[model samples]
Target chain A: MTGRHPLVGALSAVALTFLLGPILLVVGVAFTAGDTIEFPPRGLSLRWFAQALSYGPFLEALRTSLLVAMAGTVLALALGLPVALALGRGGARSRGAIGTLFTLPVVVPELVLGYALFQILMVTFRVSAFGALLAGHTVLLLPYAVRVTGSSLAQADRSLEEAARGLGAGGWATFTRVTLPVIAPGVAAACVLSLVTSFNNVPLSLLLNGPGTTTLPVAMLHHVEFAFDPLVAAVCTLLLVLAVAVMLVTERLAGFTDVFARQEADRWRP
Target chain B: MWRRRTTGLLLAPGLAVLALVFLYPVAVTLVAAPAGVDDGGLADRLGALAADEHIWRAAARTVRVAALVTALCLLLGLPVGFLISRSPPRRRAVLLALAVFPLLLSTVVRTYSWLVILGRTGLLSRALTGLGLTERPTQLLYTETAVVIGLTQLFTPLVIITAYGAFAHVHPDLEAAARGLGASAGSAFRRVALPLALPGVLVGATLVFAGAVTAFTTPLLLGGTRTPTLATLLYDYANVTVDWSSAAAVALVMTVVVLAAGALAARVPAKAAPS
Candidate 1:
């Protein structure tokens, strides 16, 4: 490998700062004792953090968001894992077409998706807000689950399954004992990534929300619209920490770059 | 026969989900765009709406903002991507993880952070005042510049990651050979590496532009009421006014523009494209 150039090193530092500075500032400002959002706080305190906890709408929205995200991730896994397995194992020509179809959700604009889903559910089907939100999040997250698990399945050693079968194991038994264990890390990564994607989603949540069913991000949007205070920063700080923790767990399980690298390969493969 | 059945069964649930949630709705939206019109046909009404000056202004602004964001991402991401690709494996992983960590957070949270930093009494304004760049707090929020800054920060990492993926495949010896053949380092990169990386740059640019054009939170929060983009206009028509037809028109225009850009981007040839 070549030695790092000084210019590139400097640019990296600047880029990191540019990317991470505002986020850090939000976390820092959450500790402010003052009423307004001041960068260098008058005095550090946990007042806003306490306020964000007790806030009724914020907490309710948080609950709704969590539940929806959990439901969506579970459904995506149920559907995506099987599809990934099929695509990985089958030597069919339709694999590419099916994969592209599943990936269309990621490529389409979120706003358009939201608008379309909102009309279909609200105007046509008359589905409940919670159900619509769950469906929307599932659609949004399915691609991630499929891609991650598909890569994992692609890389799994097939000989292990054959060996298990040779040892008199049935298909279900071999899959449970052999294939699932090998791809467990990838499945875990997919779950974590999809959960984060579902939780942090805004556009889909915005259109699908009904009375008393607003998600956290949509609630935050409304809160910011009316108020500008440290409480908002406090809420954002908590979520940011949660996101970072999820990412760290994903890294520990599957290695972060492996996820992206696999995604890149999947996208560019002929 | 059993394997075929199992594979088909496995794909059934996902296909059903897409059919019900994605394909059906999109089709309904496109087909229903002209519905409920009385006096004029759907086409004429859509054309009239398109001719409105406000719609044109928002469309132009959306394109301008998206273009600027794409350009900024490319300028900042290329070098970082190149550096990351060249780095050792361990260091590269750490760097990439750091770069992508922000993307995992909710865009609402990220945009809110920008609000704090760009507000009149926010960090950027305070810094400018402290440094005597301005005698008083500057109005940075609710401007196009603030929107661009926020978006660029949000998207630059994506560009870097995409570019890095492309650059990773490019044989380093190609550049080495060019340099050995009397080309300067800069020219060698421009001649060999840049062309090889064009596909990625185009992909990244398309993603950035689409994100920007379809963006609702950043423009609404950062650009304020004064700066309305197509997303905001669509929201206004669909939600605020409860006018579905007009909203559909706006959405259709936005979709067309984004798809056109993507199509054009895909048409650009990369040196590494397989014959």
Candidate 2:
């Protein structure tokens, strides 16, 4: 088949070329000296990077994004860890319903969900505290935690917990002493992804942010709506790099199998 | 047993949060959409929604795009899925890694990537001009085509992975069995192999279909203000119009549509699927 059907080889190369070309093009434009968004950028300069770094809103938004993402990831973990444990302990009917609830953050359109949360916060509770916004992000963020943690727990070796309990560990102690360490990798992967998701989320952040709480993504969204700037490219480039890097690290850690598995990659050919 | 209470207790927070963030907002919208401007019956908002041709148009546009996107995902994804699965195991792993990398890349980055390449002054424009296909850079951005391109690129990998998984799981023994009985390679793949992989194909279609409809960022960024999908339409009401009640109505509509598609997808039989 190798020689008789050279089309396979040609096809693979063409697909790779298609997928890789745009990514490289964006990276190339970031280095271009042009003021407007031009690709095959005429000249190479780092001016945009300098400007992106110095721009006040861009800087502030970066800071806010990092803080919120960190806070969101941690809060998601704190809130969702228990839920994952509960899933392990719960009845079948309840677990399914509970899962539907938890993964709402993933499936729901961010705008509607965030707007709903915004309304509840402002109109119903009158709680416009940044803390409440943080809570909203956390609530949304937790579903990933529940998903990742629940999956890791589901795939975990029950024999390990049984072995620990047989050694006289209490249920709580067994989870802490045996279960947590084994599942820590999944938790870590989830946290990293959680941070990225919340960090890059624009719609929810737009609805939720107050005077000083705008994240980088929301800031970029606003900046684009008003006018274009090269700094947007610089910011986008940095975020893209960061995202690609996160993915590389995560894939390395998790072996691309888990993420692929969840997405149902196993059905493909040999 | 500690398990019963603990499981119930553990499930409580996630479920409660869902009620708060998900179900309640939906409930608020349902209860309040009809109750607009105080003490009114279902006449005001319901009448507007029922009468509005724009709503129907937007919905039809959304469904049309979603169907197209899923179709593209299936068409582009299946062969790619088969190709990736056939790679030498080591390179296969690497290719799979490259494939899923986009899934991890934030929707923002992916959208921006397309914007850079597909924009008027972008590389794609330059490339097209260089090839003498156009006198100047063609208008590729802010069109329904661009939206499809972005979404197809985004969701295609999931389809590939799903389809690939099914293909991979297809027991070599079965194919071998067919071939041993004098079936050609093509016939073996078509008759014996493809039928067993129907579950994966069904799963892939379901995922891509659901994913395409619910997707927001790519369409918003790529399609801009011109082509509005249901998610985008709902966003417009919620944010631009500042009408949560109407937005909720729209969101509920989207939820029901997506859920129906999902249910329809689920009913697709595995082994009896059309090749």
Candidate 1 stretches with Cα past 4 Å from truth are: A1-3, A91-93, A166-168, A260-270, B33-45, B269-275
**Per-residue alpha-carbon lDDT of model 2 for B23-80, expressed as tens digits?**
7754565445322223132344566568766667778878888889888787667666
Cα lDDT tens digits, model 2, A170-254, are 9889988899998988888678767867776776776666776787776776676666556677777787687677766777777
Please give, as one word, the docking class of candidate 1.
Answer: medium
Q: For residue B221, give model 1's deviation from the true position in Å.
A: 0.8
**Residue B115 error for model 1, in Å?**
1.3
Indicate the residue-level lDDT of B59 in model 1: 91
Model 1 chain B poorest ten-residue lDDT run: B32-41
Our tally of clashes for model 1 stands at: 0
C-alpha lDDT (0 to 100) for residue A13 of candidate 1: 78
Alpha carbon lDDT at B50, candidate 1? 66
Give the lDDT of residue B247 in candidate 2: 64
RMSD of each: 2.7, 3.7
Cα TM-score per model: 0.93, 0.88
Flag clash pairs in model 1. none
